[model samples]
Target: ASPQSGYTLAVLNVGAPAAGMNAAVRSTVRIGLIHGHRMLAVHDGFEGLAYGKVRPPGIKGGETPQEVEGTPRCRGHPPRGIFHPPRTLPKKYFEEISTNISNFGIHGLIIIGGFEAFTGSLELMEGRAKYEELCIPLCVIPATVSNNVPGSDFSIGADTALNTITTTCDRIKQSAAGTKRRVFIIETMGGFCGYLATMAGLAAGADAAYIYEEHFNIHDLQ
Candidate 1:
């Protein structure tokens, strides 16, 4: 179901930030708000949740100057910035979060990360029964550079990685042309799947592209 179906969705990003982290957070928040549910952020991933680093925004009372209409007591006052202490998760952070899910009135969660991130997600999902008793749902969105997620065309970072590689390759091609270089060998990360390398090569107009998805013969390029 879409986020705007009146479900309180919490987004827990378990890995390092990338180009689209903020976008994902913003989108999730916007949709959740539209759906008529309060949104909470779990910072620093499972570590944050485990350590009780969840933060929710709310108004705190601040001193304001008043203006007097007919008397001094009626005078207007300027507003001042309010301070709110960060709420650290409880000592039994995970257990507390699970039990208090109903108390806090949360509806769902969106987890974003790579394969390793699934470990925490799986933990949460496996514990869904306990959470569901309190009315909480969990969802996951894969967003790693590995592009190893099954049955998906691309992860969140795939496009950015491809663009970076293509730009770098363009610069290298210019230098190669200037220096009269005959060959250029570019190695990229991705142990079992070379989606990034292949896409970048094709987009950057490489002489040939090598990917783990297909067999390569050295003599074919020679």
Candidate 2:
């Protein structure tokens, strides 16, 4: 018997924040919706998935109160509720998330994050298989300052971190006096490749920059 075709897949981004995190989410949602797939966003990191922090639109509302103290008499509006994800994610949160997805019939997942976060995705994939339930397709999007993920020229947050470093270095150079000898070491997040470190160092006129891609001999400085 031929297998029945499943519904179009939805994406779930499970990772840390980069400058373009929201942009990626928006794009994914738009594309998925265009293709007739239901879009769902997973809050926080993998912990969000594990603890069942999955939310849909209209689930919560805004923080500001609808009625103001000094408000004038205009048209009356309904009170809007505030949206909040689950608090106190526990170590075994993934188990809970997996159970929830299984029960709720979730079919697709998209994970976005650094190397550590990818590990969580792997775990979730394995969980999906072990339960003998419907298998969900998982996609991973790299988003780390380290730029260590192979096969990709750019990660999500690298550009933003690089810009911040350049600005800070420029300020330091302007404040230095001719008579004063100043040494500054600016450390940014790059677990492996050091792409952000190298770019920022060069743009900021750093004398030397060290990265995982190329080795730096400490004895040369001596």
Candidate 3:
């Protein structure tokens, strides 16, 4: 390997953040370490990596891995200076991210997110041949309430959002039940997907719910 940077299994999410992200990160790190692989936390998705665009310098100090505040961080490393935002930079300004996975002995990558995540996974899998000298396997984890990712029927954040919506609806029902014959017309979230509204309605035993998937009518309750 590339003189052993003392790390293994680089991971990051390129899509929007979800509620289960930190939890997934925790599990991924603890498990990878237990399995004898050191972990590197690539913050801010591919953008964080865009900075790594420049050929990564030779693996330096801290061959010994250590933990700080329940999270492992490299010691004796100076903080990075200010740089341009990820989006604002032109192709000319972008640094060339080092592509030396085999040298680092990285065996696999774990990606977490929704639809965007799926696309990123495909990109990595497709570029396996040209991107690195060694082939790296990839695992994609779904983490969103939208539950719209292909090939998977469910996602991590769906349950969390379901619980929250159910509880809130229950509270609203309790507080406003006192008003007799008062038809409560509560507006719910979930722009294109109606899973949230449908589940909240079922969990809360709501008298009615207007979801986007199935035709909903206001006159039904009457």
**lDDT (CA) per prediction:** 0.58, 0.57, 0.57
Q: What range of 10 consecutive residues in model 1 has the weakest lDDT sum? A: 66-75
Off by over 4 Å in 3: 1-7, 53-105, 128-135, 180-182, 187-191, 215-222
Q: lDDT of candidate 1 vs native?
A: 0.58
Candidate 2 clash pair list: 12-110, 50-93, 61-81, 61-82, 61-83, 146-190
Off by over 4 Å in 1: 1-7, 57-105, 128-135, 180-182, 212-222
Q: What lDDT tens digits, residue by residue, belong to model 2 across residues 1-222? A: 223334544344443445665556556654555455555555544555555556542212432212111100111222322222122222355567767677556787766656655666566556555554425677767766666656567788787888888898888788764447666667767767677887888898888887777776767544
Q: Order the candidates by lDDT, highest first — what do you get?
A: 1, 3, 2
Best TM-score goes to which candidate? 2
lDDT tens digits by residue: candidate 1, 131-173: 4532355666666666766656677777787788888888888
- Clashes per model (N, Cα, C within 3 A): 11, 6, 4
Which of 1 and 2 is the better model by lDDT? 1
Position 144, candidate 3: lDDT? 70
